[model samples]
Target: MNDKTQDIAIVGGGLAGASLALLLSHHLPQLKITLIESFPLFNSDNEKSLPSYDDRSSALSLGSCRILQTLTIWSQLKPYLTAIEKVHVSDRGHPAGTLLDYRELDDISDEEALGYVVENRHLGQVLLSALAQQSNIDTISPATVAEVTPQADEAQLVIRQGDKQQRLAANLIVIADGAHSSLREKLGIAVEKSDYGQVAVIANITSSGYHDGVAYERFTDSGPMALLPLGDFNDEHRSALVWTVDSDREADVVAMSDEAFLQTIQQRFGNRLGFFTRVGKRHIYPLALYKAKEQIRRHIVLMGNAAHAMHPVAGQGFNLALRDCSALVDTLCDATVRGQSPGELDVLNHYLSRQDLDQEKTIGTSHLLTLLFSTAETLPAFARNTGLFGLNFLPGIKAWFARQAMGVAGNRSQIAQPASSTAAEKRIK
Candidate 1:
């Protein structure tokens, strides 16, 4: 093989791209992988240099935790992770509410909890550290793919790093840049976007009362809000807040004094976690659902936010992306065993066929939840409260929904399942 030729070239070194690289390296060590990113991946002096590795936190479904455990980095992440033992969901001024407890799940144990919450920086640190130890994977930082051209058997990339440029070819190219991927557009892959006319204000918050591993999802007249439990900092009870409000009021919310913001949030969320004591820096971004027109084509595959970006109301965005990664890796591993090329269109199509249903279900559920909880109209409000009330009394339905939230409800990749399970085989056939 030429020095410039690689088995796979992954664009974007954020969470998605980095995770995919690690998985591929772990499973297919013989395949040479190249990771290209536009930002400086690491800086010991300043950890928050990368935008994706900032102060925000991610909710990792139980399935995601299982998948990461396979990568051998879960031990490093455990100290920084906060388990979500229970999820409390309610509507403002409504008597109806529902609690999803990990104990209710048949296959899960208390130690496993329902899911976990980890700061993005800590997750990034762990993933990147793991990447550094992968002998088969090469990373190029502060670099961008200027262009991508698909040939008959492979995809070629033009990488720009400072004043210099280099051309590389790979049998397969994975795009995991982000929701607003410039490379996806450069390849003429269009994205369909649905604006929710709302924005999410995110920050880390400290409360007087302990969360006790409870995650709160509160729906108010303005929009839906989530207070995900966070590991205590400096002996203070803490949580990550994602407050969705109308786009029109975003400016006012961002400009409010810390005390005023806390007061307003206390009003909207009530005394669930007790009085809000402190809040960290605030970040705001508009909420929307974006899906690429195409996810797979010959040697090119779109992964992560590049494929689908959903509202955070249900916290399914990253979990869905992680599932896609696992399925793709399983497909590629099978292809390798059969002496098939990684970039073969048939292999790529098979991978998509396996994950399409999962993507559809997750995206649909998230969209529906966003719309249902964010609306204050009489009909939707009534239906929403009634549904919550029904869930409290419906054991089977509640369990199913809990599974969905935990990311184990639908078909999963073989690698994400137990060694003896036949569900993956059934899905493959």
Candidate 2:
């Protein structure tokens, strides 16, 4: 294609793109990786959209923890992470609730947490830092991909950086630029989208007492509200809150005063952690289910939000993307070690095929959770409450839910291996 052709060129330096580069570089040291981001890597002196570096919070399932461990950045991330030892799920005003405890999972120790919650900005910083230290990985920032042309052997990209425009070529191109990826459109990939008619409002909150590392998922008439434990703040326990509300009410919710908002949250979430005394800057995003019709096309592959974006009900969006990252790494590294072309249609297709089942299960689960918890309909509400009771009533169901919350259930890939169990054991020691 060109004198400077790359082995793999990734578009978007967010979580998926950055992690993919690091994972592949670590496993296949012989291959060269180039990562391109349309926005600034982080908040700079100059104002720019730093999507990867934001105040948002993400829950990392234990399965996702293993993938990070495989990439070798988990150790650096552990200090700042707050463990999710248990997930307390309930419907507002309903006595019936489900507790997906880590102890429910077989071989899972009581000390081991089901997941960890970290600010997206912190995790992104860790991944970006790790990427920077990789000798085989090249990072590009504040650049835009004006176009992508896929040829028989390689894909070409027209990138615009500042005032200069250049043509770059690669054996394969990965698109991970989030839900509204322009490169995906340039490649003529269609997305199947369903709007949930809701918006997610996120903020940091503090309670009167300790959270004990328990995450709360409370379903109200408005929607599902999640308060993930985040250690503490100024002698008060802190948590990250994600509340889904009807699109029509989003504006009013966002406009509320902090004290009034806290009162409303207390009313909806009950006195679980005592009172939500303080609230921080709030952010909101419209909720929807968006899936790429085709995950891979010839010399290109889609990843992260570009591949599939679902509701944040289960906090599986980034977790699923990390799993997709692991599957791609496994497939490509195996093929490369065996002397196969990573850009081959068969190679890309294999990655897509393996991810399909996981994506299906995750997307379906999130959609069903959103529907069941958000609806005020009597029948669906009754069934949801019944399902919550089933989690505790049936051992098999409790174990299954625990596995899902731990992020170890669906697929068995090299990345999703029980390596984290070893880490958990070490933690216990």
Candidate 3:
């Protein structure tokens, strides 16, 4: 075997790739690893895709926070996170008793908080910065995989990188590319696609009233509209909005003037936060549920959006990816210690099964919730408020849902602790 095919090669270094790199770097410090980014840079730092600036934010479960914290990566992005003291879930245009407060769940249990909302820029910076200093990890920019072919033992990757083209071999191939992955398709892995027929509109807005760390999710006939808490910007409390709209209205929303648009937001949003004075850059993604028929192909393994593109309704895409990375990290580390191949069936299946179970359940529930809430005429009046009603009245059920949102629902790892409780405590103080 050639020297190029010794360790592992990771393609597409986004959230999934970066997290895996950090985990592997921490657990198997001596193992040689190379990460290749096909893009020259990411959108937040530079103009790559979408916009000049990405104002969209992500809802991070407390569970994910602890994973990063354990990896020594949390401190890097901690300054940019906006704590969520409570999450108010309700039907659109609902009144006081209609909402579900996360604090109520804690009264029946030990911890508090549903999750935290953080800007994508903050997370991108932390993952990027951590990768920059790792001596054992090689980061290659502006590289494209021209071809890949697996032999009896070694897998060859022909990469055409700016002004240079070369073939590299590795024991295992990892694909962390985005939702529509060319790498997975290259191996002829078939995926089932289910369009949600709605678009998730994302933008950062300056909320008129004080947020006080309250995140809100109001479900409408169109879809769930969530205003997640973020750090105050320019004396205004910033809240990132995810408004899922019918596919037909997506274009109009994207083209709306900032002032007129804020007015529209004010109408649909009502006066909970008083007003949404302004909106930063915006993005709209056509929501879909895409999952591969299989997770592995000989020497290759797919992770992140590539493995399964989930609906943003529940905000578990990245969380699931983090889970996948954790499992892969454990599998690879154990393999190295036990003198096994990183791409072996035994190790890969451990990672696959862990991800598949969560992936299936999350995609199933989120898709159903999306369909249920988005259908205005499909529900009986009382059925409309079932979940919210349960959240407001049911103690055991509410805390469980809150913990589920926090990514601490069923953590197998002791280090997989959540930060929402601590953040909630600080908010109370």
Candidate 4:
């Protein structure tokens, strides 16, 4: 174990990388951190116009919300959050809809929400602003990692910053670049990829009736669709929509007039939220599952989409990434206290080991759900409707689904537990 100051460099300052930097900065104040991002940081002024942020909304599991609170950014995000108190899951044209209510959970408090919905841009604004204020973190944005050289004792990153090229040495290098991480490719890490041949079209819609803080998951003939409750827009109830369309039909769906798009959505989603009166800008992304065959190497590790990217069917992608951040922070803090290099293969391995089960559960659950709900086969359709009906009537099964959806199942990490700040302090001490 070395007590000397260690340089930790994180590539990719998107949500995953940025959040990890913030976590390390908070828990291990003595470590010098550098966050490199190719895209310019989002700010209050330009967030509205940012292409990357275009109408995208993220559902924060209770576990993720707890982690954000420990980072002290929850307050800043609260204003933009809309609580998801209930989830209604059903198959399109089906008679029975399954309900997962926060109030139904014996352990969940009546006042607490099952989860929350926030615009990605808003979350990024909070994270980037907080990172800028941290004295220990050096954020280099609008820059790229041209090369990475992992040495016996440390890793060196060749960074291209504007007109200048500079080198940075770090004891640990974290690749959070994204699903299609160039750095991962530079490091020659192979990935297992599965394309679902579906595209997720995202937008916000104002409905005629109040959402009542309910989130809807409807499996239709087209694909899986979700309507997450959102704060009102101009006094009209709003919901963020994630509609999955076949890749072959994505172009036509996106090119449709607003009215036509709304009509199609209403037809697929039904009238649960009343008519969708107004629609916002729509953005589309191809659905895929990508898992880094290797998550840990000598002095490196991958986070977020860099490590694994799952279909958005269950909205577990970012939540699982946040859990990774917490586990990494815990492992690093322990390594630092024990005088061990955080970048050591053993240390990196320990962190990945802790995440294996979580990753498998989340990835498998989302993937299976997508396959089950995306089909229109008579047998699959009958099973889908039967499953929903059974889940609604079976308390144990419904509770299990609810817990997984809220990210409170399995080994609850310290960051996702009650008194997270106190637990974090304990871990550091």
lDDT of candidate 2 over 143-175, digit per residue (tens): 888888999989988888888887888988999
* Error at 365, model 4, angstroms: 0.7
Per-candidate clash tally = 0, 0, 0, 3
lDDT of 1 by residue, 171-239 (tens): 999998899988899889989999999999999999999999999999999899999999988899999
By lDDT, the better pick of 1 and 3 is: 1
Candidate with top TM-score is: 1
**For each candidate, what TM-score against the reference?**
0.96, 0.95, 0.90, 0.94
Worst 10 residues of 2 by lDDT: 420-429
Q: Between candidates 2 and 3, which one is better according to TM-score?
A: 2
Least accurate 10 contiguous residues by lDDT in model 1: 420-429
Q: What local lDDT does model 3 show for residue 353? A: 66
Q: Rank the candidates by lDDT, best first.
A: 1, 4, 2, 3
In the range 307-396, model 3's lDDT, one tens digit per residue, is 887878778888878877777787777677789888777778876765566667677777777777776663533565766776567766
Please report the TM-score between candidate 4 and the true structure: 0.94
Looking at model 3, the pairs that clash are none
Native-referenced Cα lDDT, model 4: 0.85
Task: Give candidate 4 misplaced runs (Cα > 4 Å).
Answer: 1-6, 42-52, 420-429
Please identify which of the two predictions, 1 or 2, would achieve the higher TM-score against the true structure. Answer: 1
lDDT of 4 by residue, 1-429 (tens): 112223799998877898899999998888899888887764466643323344689999887887888877878889999999889998887786888877666655544578999998788778888989999998877889888889999988888877888888889999888999998998899999999999999999989989998999999999999999999867888999999989999889878999999999998988888898989989889999999999989878889999999999899999999999999998888888899988999999888888899899999999999899999999889888888889878887877777788777777666667553432212211
